[model samples]
Target: MTTQFSALFPGLDNPLILKRYPDSSDANLQAWDAADEHLLKHLDESGMLPRRWLVINDSFGALTCALRARHGDTPIDFAADGRTAHLGALENLQSNSLCQQEIHFHDCSQLQSLGNDAAILMKLPKNLNFFADTLSQLSQTLRAGQQVLIGAKAKHINQSLLTLIGKNLGEANASLAWKKTRVIVVTADGKPRPLSKPNRWPVPELGLILENHSNVFAANKLDIGARLMLDNLPVGDFSQVIDLGCGNGVLGLQTARLYPNANVHFVDESAMAVASAMANWALNKLNPDLGKFHWDDCLSHLDAGISADLVLCNPPFHQGEAITDHIAWQMFNDAKRSLKPGGLLHIVGNRHLGYHVKLKRLFGNCKTIASNGKFVILQSVA
Candidate 1:
């Protein structure tokens, strides 16, 4: 796919390069939306040059990359949870041959330690609860009068988001729309805002309580697909197990409990999901070292020589706001490559997704393990 970018200001185009998918595919579907451009333009017009700046949730590195490009070697720090964002940002930076030495990277969980002098530029995340948590964290670090600017599509910048920002941070104001995008500029009042705790729910029969963060999938309850997969776990003893696209790490934790001697790997693309899984794993008293938690896009960064005897997956059919099976396709392919000879790939998916056809084509064999009206559990043995 072609790397396409749009500059909101003169000499300040945001670089966007799609990875792991061809440009000819549905990949070039607006990397930086009008909201991103509007935010950049606002920053340029304001000429508010803070010595240190923090950017959060800059999807595809657009905001961070553009800021660095405009400032020309200014120090900027970026925080994000998704492995894809980190990889994409690095790729975009390299593609543009931009000097990235001054850019600092931090995990989403470490936002509390950031300096108050840093101006926070954030993209309104799709999950409001996560957005609230981010704001709450900012509340702790930001002093009175410090500003946090948030950009989002005009349609998404509703009163609720603005209210949440005000409730968590301080007084907030929205700027006039540009290119159908609006920026909410919020100043810190130095009023302490309590962060939301992870949601806890019990799995009655399993006798396990799962703790999920707001951004985690099926946060308040067990996913029906995951419940079916848990009930139909393969009978064989598996030494090396992988829970691909593990949400809240329910599947991986169950596997760990069932096989205390086995090593279980939890892999997901969401930062909050991985954080929840790690917390739940600790809460359940599972040894942290026994479960390898990866905030990754499927198993892309997983050790290449490491092979799993059993790979359990509830592959996501979408990425961000787009509904597509490309991720599921990639997950299955990665599972096949990561499995040892005669290893098995177990998956639960919506029945209409036609995962059987994809598995059949990839592994030359597919079998139904279980099925409900809306979900199907399938298995493919290498």
Candidate 2:
């Protein structure tokens, strides 16, 4: 079930072996898509000279790895909001026997003040607000005549998108369609644009203030699924708790407040989400020792011997642009494996997802804790 493929870029010394983060068994769903190929092809044809390259929004390191393979020993500053994509790139580097020291990693917060004279390579993110924010920050770092290359599905690049790019960055144009995808070329005009701040709101009912970064789920408000889950949190004398796929750490923050004696873990694939969760935990004045934040792919990198008495999840049904249930499946399986004997996994999912079936398949029992029109809360005992 290991999903690995060779990525052949036009100018690479050899094809690099690539795999998606939180690897899935489905071969049809590859780590890289045609948009990635289209971008690389454009770069290959440009014959751009070696320079400090900034790579952003690389789904699973396809753009990063291919660039590294082509430009060895060049300074490549890789920025990804997702921890999985960052880790996946490093894993691919090791798998391909490529130099690990060639690439430098950064979270979104650290992207500012990176200085000028760098070529930027980016894959248009699913969240346009986040993309605009990124472009705004780049405007501060890139001078006139410097360009940023963006790759995306052709259908997603329209006049509005081009307008947004021009407003945030500079002149923008899409290349001719190649493989039903296009690489957007944007030049910086040396004019700095203000970056957008994270969305903040107070959930007075829960007595908590939540802030969500651009890429985090449920921006500016509580998600219905999470709301249902929050209302139906399990009654237990649990000590160690994990909020799996903890976007903005809302569930874990509540759990920490409810169980003052328990150690709560907030884990997510997004660095921005983890940072937001950490900030929220502190802003709420929760017991510092009672909270731990992890930027991770499910529980794969959780500390050893960290079995949880309760695991809470409102699992994501998508990874980047692909709307699939593989991540949800992975979260349930990981929850089962991470729970202690007699421990429980509590989850909130849309009714149509049939999460109960997956939980039953893994744990042999699934019970509905609560249900509303759109969301259902379910529990499974380990």
Candidate 3:
């Protein structure tokens, strides 16, 4: 079944066509949320568009698409931490018969390239640390007394959040609630603030140290699922191994420790996560040639020539604020497609996720290797 999201863009007569990246089969998930609509609405009502637009953290590029649709000639710059956001934005732009080349695309790491002259439009991220880092980065390049407009659910807007924004960027205030959403208007002070520092934590049992940026999952600590996965690793003389959705490279680092000669690949959608994994690999003094890092959505972009003998996964059940298993579903499917004959897929998940059922359906055999009260280690063979 095919599902398409027509954006709730009030200005456009026909809604802009949009879809989530990797295109979810589940209809419940959407490319854009209310916050995105609220931001676009504010822009429309302002009566005059910004001279130039700088958009941040657009989930699937709804804001970019709407802006492009309304004023095709305006300069629009977009940035986000996830590769999927960029890809989805590009796809949405093309689907709506808009020229993608009109928009300047930047990854989160490319914040320096984004000039401060444009009107800054932002979607309040779930990770305030990442948001603060963004503000700090903007403070460096943006002119003194510049303003940034942020859109978020009304419930998420509060004084503490405003203070955090002001502390990093400038004084902030929220607009009256509209559609259960509020626009946080922030004025950037001329002062530059230091960016968010990476977090470091030690794994005494494995003799590994991990440093991750603000957006990386379990950035500052070892998560319980990974801890459980580490204990139930499968025994195999594997050569090509992949740490699918490797966050901070914990599973891959430990796998390399167990199998010194096997090549380990760390793949993730977040640029920071990939960087963190690569850094952790070097921090552990692993063989430089044996470890590979990729900023990717699942194994969708993995090189076809590289077939994996084993895949270690601690799949994320959510994408952004949506608590859907689409990501885990895609991860499982990609792992099957990337594995060699009879290759093993080892994963850890909460007992309630019913991943065993998914594995059984995909591979025809799902083996429960280990279980605790909260987590289960499941294995499947291709």
Candidate 4:
């Protein structure tokens, strides 16, 4: 694949390169989007000198790298929940030979101390609830009259996003479209707005109450895939279990209760997901010491020798706006690598995803545990 980049900026380009797995012959997509370029251009035109800048949700480090290159010696603090984004940013910076010392990276959950002088540059996230939560966090850190610039595709920068910004922060205005991208400028009003509470609802038959933040999948209801997996939970003395893409931690929490002796590991790529899972775990009075939470890309960089006896997963089929099974492939591979001998991997997927095929290839044996109209539960032994 060609590493084509915007000529307007010399050092910035899409650096997070990976082919869509299981379909390697398919074209690799660019990591950075046009919205990233618009934000960089807005920064240039505003003559914004390097103050403490906070860049949020920068996919593949396009904005952060470009800003660093343009304002060399200026400090930029980058925050993202995705491990891939963090790693990709670092790799891109290195490829451009930029000093890493000037850039600060933070996990999304620990963003309380960003300075008052910090000018915020954000990419509108796909999840509006998560987006709103981020705005609430910004409201706490920003001083009155501070500028916050948000970049998004013109289609996504609608009245609703602007309304959310105005309600939570201060008044917001959108810039003229440039290459079908728009920059939204919001000024902090110094008045603190109440953040939206996580949604909690009952699953009556299961005798469980689940909580989810706005951006989580199936926030309003239990997902069909998860339901299928719940019904097909393996019958074994699972002493250590992991919910690999544990969105709301429902699967892990249930596993923890069912196998009281087991330690549950909850992992997801979203900071908000991790936060919600932690909250739900506490809300259910699950032993904090019994569960380990990691915001990660699959199980990459997890502690070695920390294999699990059973792993539950409902792997995501897409990454960002691109629809691909690469993440699911990675999840399956990671499960295989992290399971002890004779350990089990239980998974639920859309019927058409054909996870059985992938599991069969990875584990050398795959069993259909249960199936409904649109979802299926599959099992593999390591």
Candidate 5:
């Protein structure tokens, strides 16, 4: 895979050659999209300078890097909820030979003060609830006249979305389409709405209570695949266990409950997922010493010299809008790498995904431990 790809913006000194953060082999996919281009264009054309500016949800560093290149040394606040996206931005900054000191990065969970004079530049996220939560938080930070410029695909920018923005921030409208994208201009009214709380649910059978932040998958309840995996945890006297791609840490929490002596590691790419997992682990009153949480792309950043006796996963088939097996493949490969010899990797996946084939290829042996009509549980020894 190529380490560098270029994105061009009008009036810029150089085309930004950037890589997807966390560096994937998928060269066909880009770090930024047309909506990102449209946002930068609008920001440039308007020539609206504010006392402060914040960029949110930039998939990589496209918007922030371009802004730094054009407006040299200007301080910008960048907020992202995914560790991969945050890491990607940092990598892109260095790749483009830009000053990393020009931008301040913030975890979406822990936003700092933006003051009242700030203007916001944002790429509309796929999840509306997460968007709303962001706006709610911003409403408190911005003043009555501060504007929030939002970039989105033309089809996704509609009355309902506009109303949502209006309800959460202030009055909102969109510009005419460009590059099949539109920019929603929101004026903050200084009316702060309550940030939406993470959804909490109970698993009566497992005696586990799960709390999920807005962006976490299966926020409302246990996933069917997870339910199946929980029901059929691999029988082992495992010492170290990993819940790969653990959404809310349910699997890890259960692992702690079932195997009191095992050290359970919870890992995920989403910062919110990692935070939620940590919170759920605490909420469940599990052995605090036995729990470890990582906000990581995969096991790539997991602690060195740590091998797990068992790894549990319910691999996600998609990342953002792209429906692909790349993540699942990566998870399986990472699990294999992180497992001790003779250790087991147990996973639940959609039957149609045919994860058994990948596991068999990786481990040279795979077996179906359990299955139903839609999901299958497969295990491999490393």
Candidate 6:
């Protein structure tokens, strides 16, 4: 990633300084994208600034930082499903020396708390269902005739996309392409749409019923790798456990079921994911005292005194649109730090990911406890 980001958004007299979350080296990525620039460029040209503004799905806070830089006292509100995005945006704001005194940070779930007239600027997200859910929720609060501007790659805009927006929020239209990106203008209808029901499915085999919010990974079904890991979990005496990246808390839920005495910690970066995990734990009637749910970036912010005798992981391979192994690499390193001496890290991954190589390097020893044609379950001792 670029060590420093300098994007010349049109409204700003000077370029804004920004950086991706968990800042480090890797030149393959930048802090902002053309879509982000397109939205800001359109705003500068429109000259229709509202008393307050809400920025959504800002990736690394490029839009929030740019808007904050250009209009410091505008009472900007920022929201994203990713905790990492929130962290990145706050850092970018401080790094640029922008005053956050009037900038309000919130989750989309709290849209009702903000002013109804606040203009919304958003970058289209990768997940359509989550976007639809957000639109439905926003429609409940935003007043009629309000505009929500969404930016996306030109290739991603289409009639069907507009239709989806209309059904959920209001009428929509697209603008001329700039730098292979376009801004979508949506007019709010002020009609309340029914919120989407949480996805609930029975895992009769495991005697578990899983409920997942729209943004949770594998929310609708049991992923194949998790299925394999569930079958081959290392049987041992375990007391304290961590489910790193615990989407929907399935792994941690299973831990609570198998080892009733163990403290099962479910940690994830998505707020919906953490909430879903906690909800699922309650839904399954698991022991309340043994379950802990955390919305955090891996285990980095876990309670200081907490250490795990066992860590179960099904690490994600992608961050937003970029497919990379950096996340899995971080999870392994974090597991090593949080594990007690002689503790174990058990993970399942696609056969092609070569995770065993990294595990061996980090833990000094890695064992292939189970394998199938598509997935491999590996274990490491700290």
Model 6 alpha-carbon drift over 4 Å, by segment: none
Q: What is the C-alpha lDDT of each candidate?
A: 0.83, 0.87, 0.89, 0.80, 0.86, 0.87
Q: Distance (Å) between predicted and true CA of 105, model 4?
A: 1.8
Screening candidate 1 with a backbone cut-off below 3 angstroms (N, C-alpha, C), the clashing residue pairs are: 1-23
Q: On residues 123-189, what C-alpha lDDT tens digit does candidate 4 reach at each position?
A: 9889887787778777787889988899999988878778988987889999999889999999898
Error of 6 at 274 (Å): 0.3
Per-residue accuracy of model 6 over 249-293 as CA lDDT, tens digit each: 888888788899999999998888988899999999988898998
Cα lDDT tens digits for candidate 2, 39-126:
8888789999656888888878888888777888788888988888888888887888778675889877766676376778888888
Write down the lDDT that model 6 would get: 0.87
Clash-forming residue pairs, model 3: none
Tell me which residue pairs clash in candidate 6: 1-26, 1-27
Specify the highest-lDDT model's number. Answer: 3
Which 10 consecutive residues of model 4 have the lowest summed lDDT? 16-25
lDDT of 5 by residue, 1-382 (tens): 6656788885596799977765667766778888888888898889876666688888888888888888887788889888778888988888788998858888787543663565688889899888988888887778788888999999998889989998998999889999999998898898888878998999899888999998898988789999999889988798999999998999888888889999999999888898899999989988888898898888888987889999999998877776778888988999999999999999999999889999999999999999999999999999
Candidate that beats the other on lDDT, 1 or 2, i.e. the better one: 2
lDDT of 4: 0.80
Give lDDT tens digits, candidate 3, residues 1-382: 6579777586887878789987987899889887788777877788766778899999898899888888877888898889899889888888888877658877787675575778889999999888888888888878777788899999999889999988998999899999899999888887888877789888788788989987899967789999999888889899999999998999999999999999999999999999999989999999999999998889888999999999999999888988988899899999999999999999999999999999999999999999999999999999
Q: What's the lDDT for residue 131 in model 1? A: 86
Error of 6 at 208 (Å): 0.7
Q: Which stretches of candidate 3 lie over 4 Å from their true place?
A: none
Q: Report the lDDT of model 5 for residue 234.
A: 81
Candidate 3, residue 24: how far the Cα is off, in Å = 1.9
Backbone clashes, candidate 6: 2
Identify the runs in model 5 with alpha carbons over 4 angstroms from their true place. none
- Clash totals, every prediction: 1, 0, 0, 0, 1, 2
Error of 6 at 98 (Å): 1.2
